[model samples]
Target: MADRRLAIEAWESLFRAQHEVFEVLSNDFVGTDLSQAEYDVLLTVTRSPAMTARLRDVTANMLISQPSVSRLVDRMVGRGLVTKCNDPDDGRGALVTATDLGVRAFRAIGAAHGKRIAEQMSRLDDDELLALRALTEKLRAGVDVDEA
Candidate 1:
């Protein structure tokens, strides 16, 4: 087993690094029409098949609460960035699809944001980036296992 002190230090380092990177990258959204949370939703929805996704899936991928995601989606709906409809397979479930406006907005921001992400991540060499991705995925897999 790893030493408790070492484990704690590693966890703190990971947390702090995430916060620092997020803080820096979040600046990419400063002048955008969408907030960070809204962008996250669009990113997921836009990447899904037919440019649509289940609301539950969106909530699952988000860092916020279910109710918070619901409210955010409602606001996005009002803005015509996305449209919500009842899931055909599940009467009680909702589906969200990006509007044409949403696609254009997301694509514009995504192109710029992608460049920013690449620039920010360029701090690490390729090998280091691969290692970091592996470590994070391992950590995430452990959490998934625990949930299962």
Candidate 2:
């Protein structure tokens, strides 16, 4: 029990540190109209070979609720950043894809984010990076597949 508590606290600390780093990167580096959530959505869609995804897929990938994703997608559509199209295969599902403007915005912001992360982590040696990845993966193993 004590070991679990200690692990939880350590995980929280790591999460906080990562959040702080993201905040700094977000504020000073990626200063575009796109929010972090939007950027993530765009990246997930763009990374896929089809460069498109269904609403449910976006919600799952973004780790957000359906309503939340709907609202966000609504906003993105309003901004002409993305489009909601009827899925040809499934008449009921909507396919979401980034617009040309959305792709442009994503590229600009993503480059900045990548550069920021690279600059921040540049001081870490290869061994330290590997250690961090191993530790984080170990902590991630705590989440049961059944729970997921």
Candidate 3:
């Protein structure tokens, strides 16, 4: 096996770096209509077909718990950012669709957030970024992500 100390050190450094970079990127939500969680919701929803995504899928993409996601989606629904309805294919599942307002908000925040992310990641050159992506994908390869 790899050296235990080196493994721990590598894990710690990766965790801390992710935390710090996320903290910096989260500032893009300040003074905006969407909270980071809401933005995350829109991030998943807007990328799906017809600007709609399954509720389970949203929960999957989110860092928060399933109940919390349900509540957040409710709030978004109340705010007219998204509409929720039963998933036709699955009786127990819900489908979320972004409203025109939601799309606008997501696009506005995404443009700024994308720029900020690029600026923060500029510390790494193209080759390093590609390597980082490959490393992360490899790390995630063992994780079992559920689509249902």
Top candidate, metric lDDT? 3
Instruction: Residues 28-139, candidate 3: write the lDDT tens digits.
Output: 9999999999999999999999999999999989998899999999999999999999999999999999999999999999988999999999999999999999999998
RMSD of each: 1.7, 2.8, 2.3
Q: Stretches of candidate 1 above 4 Å error?
A: 144-148
lDDT string for model 1 (8-41, tens) is 9999999998899899989989988989999999
Candidate 2 residue-pair clash tally? 0
Question: What's model 2's overall lDDT?
Answer: 0.84
The lDDT ranking, best first, is 3, 1, 2
TM-scores for the candidates: 0.94, 0.80, 0.94
Q: Return whichever of 2 and 3 wins on TM-score.
A: 3
Q: Residue 26 in model 3: shift from native, Å?
A: 0.9
Q: Give the higher-lDDT candidate: 1 or 2.
A: 1
Model 2 residue 50 CA deviation in Å: 3.0
lDDT of each: 0.94, 0.84, 0.96
What RMSD does model 2 have? 2.8
